[model samples]
Target chain A: MQTPNTYRAGPDPDGHFGLYGGRYVAETLMPLVLAVEEAYNAANADPAFKAELDYYLKYYVGRPSPLFLAERLTRHFGGAKIYLKREELNHTGAHKINNVLGQVLLARRMGKRRIIAETGAGQHGVATATACALFDLPCVVYMGATDIARQQPNVFRMKLLGAEVVPVHSGTATLKDALNDALRDWVAHVDDTFYVIGTVAGPHPYPAMVRDFQCVIGDETRSQLHEAEGRLPDTLVACIGGGSNAMGLFHPFLDDPSVRMIGVEAGGSGIATGKHAASLNGGLPGVLHGNRTYLLQDDDGQIIDAHSISAGLDYPGIGPEHSWLNDLGRVEYVSITDREALDAFQLCSKLEGIIPALEPAHALAHVAKIAPALPRDHLLVMNMCGRGDKDIFAVADHLGVKL
Target chain B: MRERGYWLALAMSRIEKRFAALKAESRAGLIAYLVAGDPDLDTSTKLFEGVAAAGADLIEIGMPFSDPMADGPVIQAGGLRALQNGMTLRKTLALVRHLRARDADTPYVLMGYYNPIYRYGAEAFAEDAAAAGIDGLIIVDLPPEEERELADPAERAGLDLVRLATPTSDEHRLPTIVKRASGFVYYVAIAGITGTRSADADNVHRAVSQLRRFTDLPIAVGFGIKTPEQAAEVAKAADAAVVGTALVDRLAQNLDSAGKPKPGLVDAVLADIAALASGIRTVRK
Candidate 1:
């Protein structure tokens, strides 16, 4: 088995982390993909690009988000010192802003006039629209009709940001369908459009580029934890949908073998009931989107609709880096059911005065499971990736609350 | 497994024979595409035979996927309708078998994304597809970089893994694409999904002329050849004009309000095919 240090150097020159990430697209989009790859590589090497990104992240999106010690939750667990990486405090109320800001800037640098993206939970859509609004670029977001109906606030939010939200109705009408629509749009308008894939999935350069952008979460967490606790945390936890937040937090800690990482997946109902979005936990390795990774697909390779109370985690496939890490056993992956996540959602609200989004609720649910068993001296940090404002209606409906 | 030369030789024989026949007649071939179980299997099967009888030289059967990222709304709807009516990879191959049972001369190619074949097991899919008389394949999402997964098995089964060269496939990438490409080269005239925009004939001619410098394989121009006029214009530049979304659109146009196939659906599809075939046949002269 490869050590954590060896795993950090992926996805190589061909954009592959073992057999996971590569450019699996049509011929018409090849040149555009290549151009994006070249531009990203040059920007990655340019110090001016990094300086501009740092400037925006610090002043605009409010980077270096706090790492707060959840004292009440720590007392409740009574086993480990619990700390929360407060990504929910960011401008877009989620870790998604970190990636969108970087991608929109890169798109502008490449002279791309239009920006396109796919969103499931509307957080990424809101963040992408926010960046486009700030950059004065035309933006279009493809969202599933089902998602649009459920996430009406984010829909209106995107429209308010001057983005045209196209509701895709084909093929299960979810994140996968929305992604398919976005790819079709990119293919149709390859000349002037830049597809800002929300997650760390998709073709070459995406898994890597999105990971690079999101590493800010882990980078800040590492420094912040050192300043607060005088040492690295013993354990790290984050939720995984297409696994952007998890990758963001885990990439910086990969080389630190002393810090164990756990990725929590949305186990809607349960894995046994076949109604969950636990791609790494329940799915098999297959090709989807633009990369080879773990996917929820049937015997005929047709992608199955993933079920999760949180639309953000309701995707059939995961990022290739997550797939590679799962294979390497560097990061442990587990599932938390909807009922458990709901319980954690309320627990964090009352105990820590934090109403986390349903996505991070999954991570809190997993924290509830193991936090009580560890030693009090042991330290655990969880990514509070999003706030619960957008999910209040869904949670209320699930809990049968009249409000 | 047969040697590379052996597989290439056998793969070219059938496809080359069709193109050679078209060349001798001083005209281009009209390739028609249809979702295997659009609306339903029986109607799609009827449309398949009707297209061949209506003068289409080659048939491209679309194996509908649940998620077709490379397709536009029209073809995406067609696939959804097919899946709703019970379209599976196994059923699609069976449809090809049924078509090949009576008509043995025309060439048949299976085109779609790779997930279904990967799910069916690549080796088994190759065996079944070849046994069902599939001559070539054009997996839209599987590029040359990721071809090893299915290409080797398909070629071993004597099925041509027909590769696509697009408007964006620049001079540097064309060699790698045409290297393992068999049967013929599918030149996507537009840099977009199916049925969106028309391809300029001048650009199509220039691309085909450029591609001719790399390989001897017959080139087929597709994607946005919607009208008979557009098909005829494309045929003047390429060996074949492949039309898919236009045919799918005709199927959609003749559908009832409930999304069921109307009575004139087959007639409408066949009429469109006949018109396109006529336009393509008269192109060179």
Candidate 2:
């Protein structure tokens, strides 16, 4: 248990991040999962794979997105000088493209013909569809029916990219149900298919593979802040659904004991009302979707439906690495409510002239709470993980305004 | 004689007795599967009590979870109906106790995902399930690598921890799978979820033979045996043929428009089981 040497050496060789992650899938997929692991390990060691990923990230995903200081917002907070890592500027308008390119490339290298994925907010779906189109591979995405209704633009986008979007109608028709169907698809088609998991969850290699792909966010932020301020930032913050963007930003800074990290979860209405997506704050450890993590479930362990205004953040479980980091006290996990995120969404748009995604607005809400209390010299950076174009309809519906 | 001594030490578990009886009969067995509390608790209980009488050599009761990812549409709907009717792990165990009070010869295994048992407290669940007369467990989600917590507790309670060997399981992984398995090796005849496709007779034959090379336990072929023909084909390849989706489909066919069981649901399912049993009896391993 003590051999982490660093907070990043994790997942061990067997894909365990200290009991939080293991392959809990059915025996029918165990060999396939191991085969994927073997392929990923080989590709990870190959210089050509690294160079190819770098080429795609730099050209396709538009890597090294700007880290701009929000002067007006910082002055409004009157405390920490807030900076935003503008991941929303990336291709497909989210940090999800980072992982998509990495996974799709790996799928091709494994000689897989079809690509499959599951989506919650449609951002990952759109990203995967785009990558599959670029590679000219047949792609299928499983989305919850409720999500397709809310995130309609992304559905259209995926269809336009020549990807099939299948709506899952089971179990509250949400992200977890989409995941269940995607996994079922994998089991049925493991011979020629690859599953492009969007977030830092599911069974590892996935949690670790996704984190490594998205680590560009943190790696860039670290050097950018040092070049500007001559030292490490005091704090890093990001919103978490399955905790990919947060993991991306925090994993690079985990060994820096001087820096603090916070992952904000969605508090739909309130945690006490049993309607929130705050797994770490209000749930218990259990296995779901092939990994052990904090899951929102009843006493009988039936996965409870998660509620959030931001569909991206409405998952019942966090990434296993996030759960492990919470256990190690490496990153502080907190929750923000719908009203708080909505307010932050509007405030960030007006103050910084940046319309942020509802997912990152949760992180901004937490920043609003703490930034005012910190010293003026304190530096804080938050990941603006996605844009708000796909969310305007939901935002208007919540605002009681006709779109 | 040596196997009987081994059974004597464990008080002759029902699973062992059932397998021994099937061996003596020199024909493949039939396992009738049902989701506990489907449609309603009473109907499920009636069907549970009727399977053995109707000719089921073994019974498998599904402990319904909200998300049964490993099941096809029929069994998934069956589980949903059971969950809607207020079936929990506790209630399923109570049904087991009920089955034990009346019949002691028919061995039954509980099939489900691992979350419910993990939530029920694995140690407590194993002891409670064993006490309630459950013979074995086919937890689809908990592979051998992750079964240590529940396996130890289940073993201490004298429950058989059954393992599933799928078409995807290669020679290297077979040892790890059989090393921890106790009751029998469930050979998933296809590399897919339950009840979706029919197993190829040739593939089942080869896979069953391959499994025997490593494990001395009886082999049960499942996961796509939907018809009497398919069941008969699997019976020729393995020790038993498990027909879950077919029986569940029969129950579904008897249900009314609103998903409530009609008057003859029990009889229809039992008849289906009897038909499968007859078909399996036509073939010998």
- The model with the greatest DockQ is 2
Model 1: lDDT to the true structure: 0.92
What lDDT is reached at residue B196 by model 1? 85
Error of 2 at A153 (Å): 0.3
- Superposition error at B28 for model 1 (Å): 0.4
Among the numbered candidates, top TM-score falls to: 2
**Fraction of reference contacts reproduced per prediction?**
0.89, 0.87
How much is A205 displaced in model 2, in angstroms? 1.0
Over the stretch A1-403, how does candidate 2's per-residue lDDT look in tens digits?
3535689888987788997989999998888889889999999999999999999889888888999999999999999999999999999999999999999999999999999999999999999999999999999999999999999999999999999999999788999999999999999997999999999998868999999999999999999999999899999999999999999999989998999999999999999888899999999999999999999999999989999999999999999999998988888999999999999999999999899999999999999999999999999999999999999999989989996
Worst 10 residues of 2 chain A by lDDT: A1-10
Query: Can you list the residue pairs that collide in candidate 1?
Result: none
Q: What are the per-residue Cα lDDT tens digits for candidate 1 across B1-285?
A: 777967765646567778878888999999999999998998998899888899899999999998888888899899989988988999999999999998887999999998888878889999999999999999999998888979999989999999999887878999999999889999999888888888888999999999999999999999889988989998888999999999999999999899988999999999999999988876774
Full-model lDDT for every candidate: 0.92, 0.92
lDDT of 1 by residue, A287-391 (tens): 888998999988778888999999999999999999999999999999999999999999999999999999999999999989999999898999999999999
All DockQ scores = 0.76, 0.85
State the DockQ, from 0 to 1, for candidate 1.
0.76
